[model samples]
Target: MPHAKTTPFAMPLPDALAHVDRVFGIGTILADEGQDIVAPYYVQSEPGYKRVHSEKGCMHMALNTDGVYTADGYFTQIREVADQIRQVQATRVLELGSGMGFNTIALAPDHGQVTFTGLDLMAHHVSTARNDAGHLPNASFRQGSYTEIPEDLRGADVVFGFETLCYAADLDAVADQIAAALAPGGRFVMYDGFRRADFAAAPQDVQTAARLFEVTTAVTNGFHTIEAWDAALRRAGLVVLRSQDLTDASIAGLRYLHNRSARFFRSWKYRLLRHVMPKYLIRNAVAGLVGPYMIEGAGPRSGDTMGAITYSVLVVEKPR
Candidate 1:
């Protein structure tokens, strides 16, 4: 069962689904006619993502290794981000959208000199992360949006997020906010998926899937293409230090998700529920959790390359 906190919503479907269906080559469902799907809350806070992490006390979207569902793989992502922070000798680190404090708690003990402060949008997530990181004195968490960096939170030596910025309603706003929060020469590192620059030029089927993935993932306006990312960073007056496409490396974990979804869909319990529950509910359940992954493949694929999106690591530095 999904985590109890991961509540499902049946909002009036917005006009976005048709575009999604057209992009991904899927037929429109009757579910889109009246009540559509929407997740007003954070995607990481969703049942599927949260339930898995609640079991092991860590939640992250990036894969640590091929076929590795363990928290270790997630930690590998944390370590990479942490390593980047360390290289720049940042003593004050801010993690925007630090869901459940997994990254904060994981990196705090290892680098005691660097104070890790996590800011999240959900109060519940703040509480949960604080409880999880209670033993780590170097770690702290607060409830807030990354788009609006409070004055006192400014001047961080390093700021980062893993698949978090996609929650922003305005990527440009987020870029500007990060720039304002960091000290001169401070670094900002992000690991997230982005649409390809030529996504619109992709084959019709790929375009539909890309749109579907965006709507289903609740990142419709927030998911930026790589080209958009560069422009946004530069516009915010931050210099791009490095941008590495980790799409291939991230595929293993995605494949694992596909396998898991296949198992769940094939389960006898789910089969029985199909007849017992309302069709819309089932559709919402799958659309909320499974559909995004299906369109995106097991991992990141370029918009024109057949996958819904591609993942990348972008490191930028504020001018001194």
Candidate 2:
């Protein structure tokens, strides 16, 4: 993407304000109760999906089948994740970007004696999750950045992130922190999107779409490819055990979002807001409310069909 043309003077009112608002909105929405995780604005897909999984799509397909959130079967997938943690016999586990602690609450009981420490960047998310998991004595939530896992929190047997690592401006440092936090032979499992190694080789339209997705979603470094992620892990003293591309199955989420956004965009409220709201507020609102859908739309175009992006699950281990 070409650099934006800047004037010799400071940026104008709403433009500068819009930029700040967008950034702040992205950071704060985790705690926004108005957004429902059950029907998250940013709908997520499971690990494996056929062209059409069900009447509603992979999400419903997973839900009806007792599937974990955006993952495969509930029992089987959770068993696998638990088993991976069990491999090291992790009594204490750390989850980065724990969001509302839904995943932690869902998976904690299955592990019996294992304890889960959920960390998120938003304090409200932490408090809300704490309340949500009040019954789960083994699960706890705190606010913190993924870039630096606190010293006291280090030495966890496993560290996992679910679609959260993309927010890191320094993935290498994040990886290093995870490595430092893990016990020898500890595991790190992540489910997120990555740019293809040959993403640059994709068509111009696809390239632009990918860039827009990053900009819209406020991703620090945006999507990464397996090669880049693998290199980062290796540099941080972690070994990549598995990287499974799920781009095809994940397209359903994007398709669902695009359709959903189409209806909302045509609504009178949205129309009024677009034209009547101040430029900064409008930009911030779009970035918070609609930007995710726009970014989701780009997924299939850049990932599933264009081969420029891949949504994948990664399993890595720290050397013993």
Candidate 3:
């Protein structure tokens, strides 16, 4: 893989903090309760995600393996899911928090023999996904929460969630649900931002950036550590197959969004629009700008590599 030309955390920690404070009152950002905000946040953020993230309705970060950001990078997680489907010869696939059905819809057409069901907390998201997937008879979406996978949806050969598991209020509970939902020998895959094991030891600014990113993105309580997830999954009797940090692969895409978000802060017109836009929607800029810092720490000039969060993939299996 080629190295990213754009460096992570190119913006100094102090500068990033000040920018966040200016764009969103620091106190207001900190005061957000984060409770019951997931559905509303997605509802408010749908338009922005469509316009900025991907018109195809991807609600997750792009993984730019080639060191350059492109719309195609959004397919990285989908590609991984496809690989798992093939590996397991998955006849039934279940996606948790399947926002807009991007991954399922993308995979359904190619895997005509597979049946894909997406469950999301928001009806609007399910409706949107269902509408987008109307042409694909193999794909279907319904409004539901991963906290309780429907009995009929259980026994999936492949279960995956992209960036949505962070909103899980109870990791152990969700893990149990996932484990139960999968058949023996089935694979469970997830890609999301995680708190590093040593997150507490990271610099204060980096921690702040991570919190801001989490809250702004509706992960209000903060992201769970990879260690926590590993333990939770294991306790639920799932065997961990892979736990790899892919933060570096995410830099190019983060930088791309950061630069785009920076434009809002740099110009008065964009700043003015923040007042009129939905609070949660406009705050996405704050998340976009500080995302790299949370993952990569202070800039190259400072030589600080102490990061508080990581973008990672976790794959587990229910033993046969």
Candidate 4:
């Protein structure tokens, strides 16, 4: 229920669940841990945001959907929400914060007769995204949370949840659990963290405290503007089709993914594994100055914290 400026953390969520179970498997917990998630501030905030946005801007190493992303190759805004959910060829689909499964294997082979589910709340990353959905076959996985409402996702048809609804503190109970699990007039695509005007002309308030003031994860940011997601989609009955502004194409593909993630973090094989790998360290100076302040300078970036992508992405509809 953390809203009204959520900054409250007494510290410690890492018992590391048996060190994330005797050192991850399931391809390094859904595809590499990216330096044990930047060494602290609970891996850059919000109850370990499912392995930090599924390996923060997964440079397409997110189980190959024809890979390539150095961050902000947000799989081309998840391929325009998988071509509008494969032109609604959906039968049953659901995803709500299925991080580390990278859009549940990039929207599960384009709705393989749907029936794809993936919920999450650190149920061990939904048991490592069901072992990274290996054989795929009408995928399945659940850990529950959207305040737990299963019943075969009611009438599911389409419901993808990106950027995990700004770590929902309760956006009208997660938009009434995506309008009671769609299917009546299903449709619910997403993208999160909206509040623009160039992120309120950046005077710094995008927080997640370790000691940079504080505000770990939203308690209230239901699409902070875009007229607050059209008044939270008419108070969760949903009905907004086609909405885009991939925030200036995600700030020009995060400027070509912060210059190819600073040449893959200064390659010489990752600076010789950050110099003789002590587990390729990271003590976060704002995610190591966010790939060298967005690829080595052009000035004023208000000292990078991944320069907040300022967002919006919608398909929404649910009221037959």
Each model's Cα RMSD = 8.0, 11.5, 1.5, 17.1
Candidate 2 per-residue lDDT, tens place, 143-182, comes to: 8877878898888888888767766567688888989999
- Please report the candidate that would top lDDT against the real structure: 3
On TM-score, the leading prediction is: 3
What count of clashes does model 1 give? 9
- Per-model TM-score, in order, reads 0.77, 0.68, 0.97, 0.29
lDDT tens readout by residue for model 3, 189-226 = 99999998889999988888888898899998889998
| Candidate 1 global TM-score | 0.77
**Clashing residue pairs found in predicted model 3:** none
List the lowest-lDDT window of 10 residues for candidate 2.
1-10
**In model 2, what are the clashing residue pairs, if there are any?**
194-224, 195-224
* 10 residues in a row with least lDDT, candidate 1: 4-13
Kindly report which residue stretches of model 4 are placed more than 4 angstroms away from their true locations once superposed: 1-91, 96-98, 102-114, 117-156, 164-184, 187-191, 198-315
Q: Write the per-residue lDDT of candidate 4 for residues 1-320, one digit (tens) a residue.
A: 22211221111112212222233221333232222232233223423333333442231211112222234455765676567667776678788867456666776786677678878766556766688787798888877776666876778878877766655555677778778888877788877545543444333323211111012122122235455655676698788887775443333333333344344333456434433423212222122223122211212333333333345677888877
Question: lDDT, candidate 1, residue 117?
Answer: 93
